[model samples]
Target: MNLYNLNPKYRILVTGGAGFIGSNLCESLLANGNTVVCLDNFATGKKSNVTPFLSNKKFTLIDGDIRNLSDCHKACEKVDYVLHQAALGSVPRSMNDPITSNDVNVTGFLNMLVAARDAKVKRFVYAASSSTYGDSKNMPKIEDVIGKPLSPYAITKYVNELYADVFSKTYGLETIGLRYFNVFGRRQDPAGAYAAVIPKFVMQLMNHESPHVNGDGSFSRDFTYIDNVIQMNIKSLVTNNTLAVNTVYNVAYGKRTSLNELLDLLKEYLTEFDLKIGSVKTTYGPIRKGDVPHSLASIEKAKELVGYNPEYNIREGLREAVQWYWNNLK
Candidate 1:
């Protein structure tokens, strides 16, 4: 009956749509009969990620920088929804170049917010991060309780939420923030210094390199899958609840998986490819600055408010993710 249908003429703008999470969102939106306009600067995003969908009639790509106001405004023209995902993404990388990171994550986010507000889009959905928890000792992090930001990147993401709230109050814009927790899956790049732990560890194990485990393999995360992320985005964009507007949700599976457990799971999944592979040995390194000792989320609010249900746990997510890496990258 096409109950989930939106206006076929509805055009959506996905900034950083060539990046991992953004590209996945773009693909999902296009599948559901929406015109997707993707704007990317290719800083951390790769062209290959978006190449497969180039010929889609409803998809358009604009190779542009979000740090530039003109580019942000150009992409927002005639868009019904704005999914802002472009930013400098890593804790360590932000430490190395805090100025550039702030420029892109903070200043650039402000630029996008201004553009989206002026365009008067139906909704603005953004990729917020769990790193906003900072050094808070809470086990299951609630949206209300937060601590001082531990890193430049954390500061940037937290600032996004702040600006979104202000935009909603001042400009009457509809904004939803999804605070993602260690999201990983297919097409997640593994070949960089700032590579996420899941992909980076899988790649190292595939090549028989010793994977480094920081801080005794005890630090944990509430790793979420890409599909769950997509689900949250869809719900955020279309929800009828007034309470959801100008609100932030913890987008995660609500389960904690330690680093040691994750590595063991990866090795077990990858061994099916080559049983004779070397033992997956990991070297312990000192803990990193700005790194949270542990992270877990209380997704109760998201569940109650938006009907947000995460379908993948760590094992299931890693299973699918490792298979993708084996098939494509290996």
Candidate 2:
């Protein structure tokens, strides 16, 4: 179902390789016998995430900030491919401090692009957010059609796609952007104020606390798993089709789950371990600013081009996520 036969053959650099998605990518790249150089400043990245890989002979960790062009250049040295995942992510966080968000997401992104171009890397695959589909009533969002951005974070991610396009056209650097929806899995930090909904809810429910739901728990998202994203990233790197090089792809499980349904599923899974979790309630609150009511993705582009067939649905991934939190945090 996946292009698992193709193994990476060159050195790769993963910026923000200590964060949730970044760390997972680093692990996969290294496991496939590629030399991995991980660049992370640990602003939001956890040291524990990368600690397990520290002893691997093929793995190297560079403690550097992507905001600094010199640091970016340093990380790009001798790297054949760049998986750019470094950025301050969270719509609400950007809403509170748009200036900082711009600096990290926009300026830092430009620095990585320039560094990748200067180093003559074969390809640059950067994480694009689904928030870019802002204010659009479109269901099953495709790659081509996008609406105006709703938040500073969305603006920064949309700008990333623009920069990638410009780099591909102007500098001839191969680039691909994966527009990820609500990605969730093990190792995604659930302790922060801006933690993602799934992980946040898992932790709250584990503690027997009523998880809060925004807007009557009607909002939904195309919750994708970590493995599906990793598959898409690997596919983006290994694909030989020239037309698929300089474009974007929607990364999701092709299904949406509402908040209320998600909580019910989580409780159902957790109750297998503890009977009391089944009685936990959910709190409703006003919808937060920069929030969208629903999100779904048309993954046909990815499937037709790169053969990206996601293996995990919300229930499958949520079961694993809840188990991890119970085993690790309980």
- Cα lDDT, all candidates: 0.91, 0.92
Supply every candidate's count of residue pairs whose N, Cα or C atoms clash at under 3 angstroms.
0, 0
In Å, residue 82's CA in model 1 sits off its true spot by 0.6
> Residue 182 error for model 1, in Å?
0.2
Clashing pairs in 1: none
Candidate 1 has an lDDT of 0.91
lDDT of 2 by residue, 104-161 (tens): 9999999999999999999999999999999888898988898999999999999999
Residue-wise lDDT of candidate 1 within 36-116, one digit each (tens)?
999999999999999988999899999999999999999999999998899889999999999999999999999999999
TM-score of model 1 vs. true structure: 0.97
| Model 1 steric clash total | 0
- Candidate 1 lDDT score at position 192: 86
